[model samples]
Target: MSARISNNLRSAKAVAAALSDSEDERLSENSNDGSVFLVSNDEDSEIEKVKGEDVITEYEDDDEFDLETEPASKQRRLNKGADRQSCRGSRSSGNPNFSTNTKNDDMDVETPVEAFRVLFDDAILDKIIIHTNEEIERVMCLLISKEHQCQSIHKKIDKEELCAYLGLCFYSAYFKENESCVKDMWDDVFGRGIYRATLSGKRFEFLNRVLRFDDKNTRSERRATDKLAPIREIWDIFIQNCTNNFEPANNCTIDEQHKPEIIMSYNCYKGATDTFGEKSHEFSTARRTARWPLRFFYNMLDQSAVNARVAYNLNADNPRLSRKKFLKKLAFGLVEPHLRRRLGIATIRASIKKIIRKLLEIDEHVPAVVSVIKENTRSKCHLCDSNAVGRTRMKCPNCLRRMCDDHRTAICVECSAAN
Candidate 1:
């Protein structure tokens, strides 16, 4: 019984040996195939061994592998040597031709408003004005009730008022009062007086409500395919302006995650955006509204203010300008032209006239002395009705034209009070 058991154990050992020899032979035969088996080894040795195996498999069917009978290590060394020699041959000392054609840097931009205008020019303003007026008219047409019609009787916004509205928006941002209630902002006791002086609270609220970037009638059609249909036209214009005005450096990268601190400091793109968000949040002109377009408009204004600062700083010759002062100047500059236009109306108060003149740097018109000419030389008043033929010896010194007493009196009042 012991001999039989010993014989079975010996047979089992022989069968295992035979199976091991067959596996080794199969592995050797399939070695040329592109199959890799991982084995336990030192980290560096494993890496090198895998790399060596990869190189051998890649060139297995090549003429180079057929001609070379070297060991795997010798082959790897030869490949490394060849790679080094190829790199040396391909290396060049010549510098790459890279240049920036940024128009903002080359521009003669001096003020914050001028820089702001680079992004939001008259064309954009005109577009806003047109759309805003269209929106107002549309709302007015929809008002069938007498009470609603009376409430909607506000005049359509013009270029000047639009500018003033934008200026006020910037002013709100500068003062960090955007989130404040309109009543609080316009309060005589605690509010900044400029808000009241620049625009009526009701007028501002009306402008904000009707301010449109695009035509509402056509928006639905465009919205079917465009996610940004509401502000697409304005956004396109802004993007084109940015592309024309600014050019990024070649070394700039836009990676938001795992960025090196040094790279973040050098690249203004991310820094500017972050600063814009921070500063805008501190003084955002956006109110909590259901309309996303208005929020986007507020964001555009914020970005414009930030971009304007960068543009303003491009000129080193300018005085050190703070953001508040910069925004004040920018806002005033935008509203000044419209204010001057309003001065032409006769109904404006004398005190308001003097203020407007001072702000516009206009030399007040001197009161023209009415001089009498010889009766023979007197002609019909230039401003009088042709049928009336009111001949006057009195002549307006400013226009150097003959005027009747009625026209002359009106001119005298305007000239005297303009100062």
Candidate 2:
């Protein structure tokens, strides 16, 4: 009985398959002919039979189509579906495309020196909150520009050349800008992330090089004036603002793990139990002569100590020397070998002597003004050293120096004479 039923069903399936093909051809012919389409009962009966056979056929295939035994085409389709779904989710969630490279085509080629000037013009520069941004960009531009000119003569710019350009550029412009704002942004520019290419592994190693420019301030300037504290304070503010406030949507996540301290202690004092001391080399002398500002010296030493300790912990085989020895070593390392390699120590020393002489002259000239101004300006004008100072009066139309009500022609007597 079952054999008879199976034979009958197979014959019915064959008849249904033939009718399905006939119907498909008729539908296509009618579609092209644009005639009145008709679904007769005979065609409907044939369609129902075909659909029943298709269901049976799908069941048979599903039984044979074990996922483990599925063909590569099926697997590929499955994977493609999953990938599409994941991409949809990523797009919906605002996933950052971190893989996009930051370097532009112009960055690799001969970058125009004016590229920096364009980047730092008032429109872009005014948006920067960090104080060091403008100065750093300026110096970077100057160094790169100067090096570009030098390299044009030779036809190349290498990594060392780039670094030396940075060093010279930064050092040259260090004292020319407003010191207060410069000091405030010290950490963000020099202490953290990758500014130019300084390594933070050495504690305040980079910052110490930076603060060298400001070390010449007279004793009075060293005191906390109304303006701002020394360079270290500037760095602290930068670090605080950057870590706590700035919203970095793209870069690496910086957290407490990275900033282990408010400021790293460069030199440690073994003898003292004080919170700030850890017996560093600069401690004794700095305390004795009071040559450097105590706060600035402490900050420098602390940063150095922190870096030295980190280096020691990392087992970095960097040359370890006493405080005085390290300065000499760093100074020696600072001299550019490509340009001055042939120069002898005597020539270098002579250059150093000239720099020292110039520095001393500045020191003498600055103090003379300070003393004279102190005597006369008890509350007097900085230019004329006269008590001719007042508020709510027009400035000297010529000199623009503020003058007393009596002097509001405010023809600064000094400017009047100059004309």
CA RMSD, predictions in order: 18.8, 28.3
Put down candidate 2 lDDT per residue, 1-419, tens digits, no spaces.
33443343344345444445465433221344342212233422221122222224322322221223458657756665565466545533655631122123232212112222222223322222233233344445677878743222222223333333333323322222212232332344443112112212221222233222222344247555623343444444434422332223342222222222211211111111222243333322121223244345434333333223322222224334444343323222332432232122243333333333342242312211111111223233334444544333334444555454454332333223223
- Superposed model 1: Cα runs more than 4 Å off: 1-101, 104-106, 144-153, 251-273, 343-419
For model 2, the stretches where C-alpha displacement exceeds 4 angstroms are 1-233, 237-278, 281-306, 309-313, 316-328, 335-419
TM per model? 0.57, 0.20
Per-model CA lDDT versus the true structure = 0.66, 0.32
Instruction: Single out the weakest 10-residue window by summed lDDT for candidate 1.
Output: 91-100
Cα lDDT over the full model 2: 0.32
lDDT of candidate 1 over 1-419, digit per residue (tens): 33443343344334434444465433221355444333333333221122235423423432323324567657766675675444334322221222234575567588777889899988788889899889887777777444465362367987777878888888887777888888899886898656665566888888888889988889999999998999988988987887888775553334343233333123223443344467667656677577998899898888788667767765778886877778778888877776767678676566566667777788876666555443457688888877995678877766778877888554355556564
